[model samples]
Target: MKAAVAAILAGMVIAGGVSAQTAAPAVKEDFKPSSLNQPGQQFPQVNSQGYARFRIVAPDAQAVKVSLGLGGRGGTVLAKGADGIWTGTSEGPLDEGFHYYHLTVDGGTFNDPGTLNYFGSTRWESGIEIPANDAEFYALKSVPHGNVSQVLFPSPSTGAQRRAFVYTPPGYDAAAGTRYPVLYLQHGWGEDETAWSNQGHANLIMDNLIAAGKTRPFIIVMTYGMTNDARPGTLPNFDVKPFETVLVKELIPYIDGHFRTLSDRGHRAMAGLSMGGFETKAIAPKNLDTFAYIGLLSGGTFSLEDVNGTPGYKDKVKLTFVSFGSRELEGNRAGPPGQPRADPRVNAEALKGAGYNSAFYVSPNTGHEFLTWRRSLYQLAPLLFRD
Candidate 1:
C-alpha cells in the first residue's frame, strides 16, 4: 500500500474495492521459478538480490509489459526477440514479499501464465513472491500445521449468507473440549476473506508461532470486510454501520455457537490492515466489550483523545497494539496534502503514560504491505489476551 493509498483509504473500506539494487556485484545465477508459479512452469524468476526477470511468450503481439518493479516507472517493458518471445528484467530489485501484477500485452491486460493468482484490485491477478530474509518465521517447517476452512454464516442484517475463513490451530480437533481464544482478522480494501489465508498466510504464521510455543493457540476468523459500497478514493463517504452490524450482531454469535471459542471479550481480539485497519480503529474503540485486544496494522491510530473519549477503553481494552511499516512514516505528512498527519507514536506513548495498556511497533524496511502486517501480527499475537 502506498502512502497516498493509506490516506484516501482512511475513512472506510466499504466493500470491494521496492528494494534498492545491490552494488556492482554480478546477478546471482541462482534464479528459480517464483514460488507463486504453477507446477512445471518457469520464467518469472527472482534472484537472491530480489531482482525479477520475466519471459512472456507472445507470438503475435506488439508489446508486453510486466506491471511490477520500480514503483515509479510504468513497469518493465519486455523487448521482442527473433524467437517471438518477449523478455525483460526489472529495472531494480523489488521489495521482498508477495506482489500482485498483470501483463499489459499489446494494450490488453492479462495475467502471467506462469504465476499463481491472488485477489487484489478487486480481481484475480498474477502474484509473485520475492523471498524475505525473515520469511522463515512464516515458513512451512516440520511444525504442526493448522487447517483453514470456509464457512457460510447467515446474516440477518444483509439478508444473505456471508462467507468467512476459520483457522483452527493444530490439535484443535483432537483436544475436543479445549476452548481457544479468537482473533477476528480483516483484510485491506480490494481484498476478501482469502487475502489473509492465501496471500498473507495467516495460518502458517499462527502455526509456526504455536509450534514454537511463542504464542498461545487461537482461532482466526476472516471475512469480507463489507467494503463494496463506495468506490476507491471515496472512502470518506462510505458508511461503516452496515458492516459493524453484521460483525457484532450476526457473525460473532455464529462463531461462538459453532466453534469451541472462549466466547468472551477477554479472549477475543480484532485487527486489520490498511482499510481493514480503518475499520478496526472505528469499531474496536466503540465496542470494547466485544474486543479485548485491538491492533491496527498500517491502518490508523488510536490517539489519547480516542482512549479518553471512549466509554470503557481504559479498563476493557486489554491490549492496544499500533504498528506501521517503517517506510509508511517516511514523509512528514502521513495523510493527504491538506490533512495533518496524526502521530501514532505520540498517541501510543500518551496512552501508556496515562496507564493504558498500549504497545507500538514499526516493521523494519517495509512499506504498507503484507511484510509489514505479517511482522505486526507476529509481534501483536504475543501481547494479546495476556490478561
Candidate 2:
C-alpha cells in the first residue's frame, strides 16, 4: 500500500509539471506592417561618377516630378507594387559641383524625405553626399584657407554704421611684406551683405579658384546694396546714391586703414549683380579714379549713351566685363507687337565700340538664375588684377 502511494505521488508531481509547462504564455511577435512607411528605404546609392537613381515611396500620388534646377529634369516615375513605392532613375554623369533638387508631387513642392537639401548656401539636415571624380571645385583641399569676417564700420558720408563682409586671402598675414588688391562685390535686390557667402558661395569659390591658380589672391568686400526698406522688386523710396558714397568714402577708407590693401585705383575693382550691378556701373564710372576694373554680372546700366552722356565719362577705366544669361533678354526689353524694344546687346556692342576694354559673355540655355551668376563669378575672377 505504501509503494502504491509513492507511485501515485510521483505521477501527481509529473502531472503538475506538465500543467505548469503548458500554462506558460506564448512569445508574441512585436512586428507591425505600418513600420515600412519610411520613404528613404527606396533611395539608390549615388555612384562616384555623380550618377544616382532616386526613388520615392509615394504610392498614393498619381504623378511625381523631380525639379532639378539647371541639372536637367527627371522623368515621371510611377509607383510599384502594393507598397506604394515610386522609383525612377536619374542618369547624370553630372558636373563636378554641388547640385540642388526637389520633388514635385502632383504640382506641389516637397523636400525629399531621404535626400539632402541645399536651398542657398546653408546645408540642410536631409541630403545625400555625392562623391565627385574631381571635386576640386567643391571639395575642401589642403590649400591655405581665408577668414570671412562680418564687421560694422562707421560711414562718414551717411554718418551711420554700415555692415560689410571682408575676405582676407590665404597667407595674408604671413606675407606681411606684400599687399593685396581688393574687390568690392555687391549683392542684388532682396539680399544683404551675407548674400555672397550664403547663396553665392563666394568664399568657397574664391578659395578653390586661388588653390587651383585660376584667380589672383585678393580681398573681397561685400556690402548691403539697398539703403531703404523697400519691398523687393520695387523701386526704393530713397536714392542709392548715398549708399554708393558710403562705400567709396567711408568703407574703402576704413578697409584700407585696417587691412593690408593696395589702396589705389590700380589695385581696386568693383563688381556686382542686378541692382548692385547698376550701382557698379553708376558708381565706378563716376569715381574712375577709385576703381580700375569693373564687372557687371547679369544686370547693369550698360548703355553706351548713358556712359557717354554722363559728365566727365571717358576711358579712365581699365577693364569692363559684361555678362548676361540668354533668358534675361525677354524681360529686359519692352515694346509693342509691331516694333520690338531696343535690345541690351546693342548697348554692349556700343560699349565695345567706345574703345572700353569691354567683353560680353552670354551663358547659353540659362535664365536669370543664380547658376549663371555663380558660373560667371568663376570665369570672371581670373580676368581681374591682371598686369
Candidate 3:
C-alpha cells in the first residue's frame, strides 16, 4: 500500500515539481518579464538561463518568500530594500516550461499579483513560464486558430450537468460535410478542463501543427477526469467507474451527436498527462472498442504482459503512445511493491517488436511538467489517425 501511494503521488510531483539544484555559475544579467505576467506587472522575471527573480512589495512584513527556488532552499527568501520591495533570485536555474508557485509572505500564503493564476495543486497558483527552446510548437502563431467552446452535457449517472471544453479545428463549421477525428484529452489531478487550453495550450499546438500540414485536423475534447475523489488518504481505493460511465456512456454519445465527428472507433483517441495519463491507462485500454489510439504522458508505463492480458486489445487498439520528461527517468520508477519497474522506453521497443504501433518520446531537461506534455502532444498529434 505504501508503494501504491508513492506511485500515485509520483505523477503529482515527479522530481519535486522543478526540483532544486546545488551551486551554479554567476547569475546572468539578461532578465526579462515572464510571458505570463499580467499587464504592466514586471516583478516576476525570468532570465535566459531559467533562473527566476521575484520582487514582492511588503512594507511591514517580517519576511517575504517566493515558493520557487533551487538548491533545496524550498523557496527564495527576499531581502527587503529601502524601497520596501523584497527581491531575490533563485539559487540556480529551473526547468523549462510552466510551473505553479505561490508566495509565503510573513508566514501567510498568497498568490503573486503580477502573473496569471492557474489551477494546480488543488488550488489557484501563480504561474511562471521559463522560455523553452521548442516553445514555438505551442506558441501563439499567425496561423489558423481553433475554437475551444465550453460544453455542458447531462450526466444521468452522476445526476448533474458535467462540463467539458471541445476544440474544433479551424474551418470546422465552414466545412459542413467534412468530418474530423476526436481525441478525448483529460487533465491531471487538481486540474479541470481548462488546464489543457490555458496552461498546456492544446488548441494553439494543434493550430500550428495543422497549419503547417504536420497533422490532420481533429476535434479535441477535454473534461474533468473526476479525480477529486482520489484525494489524499482515499487514493488507495480510488475507482474509475464513475468517470468511465460519464465519459464512455454519456459524453462520447453527446459529442458524436452534436459535432461533425468521425464517430467510429478507428477515428477516436484518448490521452492525458500525469494523473490524467493514469486515468487514460485505466479507461482506454479496457474499452478498446471506444478508443483506438492511447497516449500516456508521464502517467505510467505498460508492459507486454499487461497488454496481452487485456481482452481484444491486440485486434482493436491502433497506437500506444507513451512519453515522459528526461528528468522523470532519474526519479522513482518503481511500482506497487512486488511489481518491477518497467522502463517505458524499453516497453515501447518491446511493443514495436511485437507488431504494435508504439511510439515513445522524452522532453529534454524537463520533469513531469507542462512542457513535457506540450512536446508530447506535438509529437503525438502528427502520428494520430495516420491511416
Q: Which candidate is the best by lDDT?
A: 3
Q: Candidate 1 lDDT, tens digit per residue, 137-206?
A: 8888898998999999999889999999999999998999899899999998878889999989889999
Question: Which lDDT value does model 2 have at 139?
Answer: 44
Q: Candidate 1: where is the Cα deviation over 4 Å?
A: 1-17, 20-26
* TM-score of each model, in listed order: 0.94, 0.65, 0.95
The global C-alpha lDDT for each of the candidates, from Candidate 1 onward, is: 0.83, 0.63, 0.86
Give a tens-digit lDDT track for model 3, residues 138-204: 9899998989999999999999999999999999979999999999998888888899999999999
TM-score-best of 1 and 3: 3
Q: After superposition, how far is residue 2 of candidate 3 from its true place, in Å?
A: 9.2
lDDT tens digits by residue: candidate 2, 270-300? 9987656766876887888899888887654
Better of 1 and 2 by TM-score: 1
Ranking of predictions according to lDDT: 3, 1, 2
Evaluated at residue 315, the lDDT of candidate 2 is 53
RMSD to the hidden true structure, all candidates: 3.3, 23.5, 2.1
What candidate 3 gets wrong by more than 4 Å, as runs, is 1-5, 15-23, 71-73, 331-340
lDDT of 2: 0.63
Task: Indicate the worst ten consecutive residues by lDDT in candidate 1.
Answer: 8-17
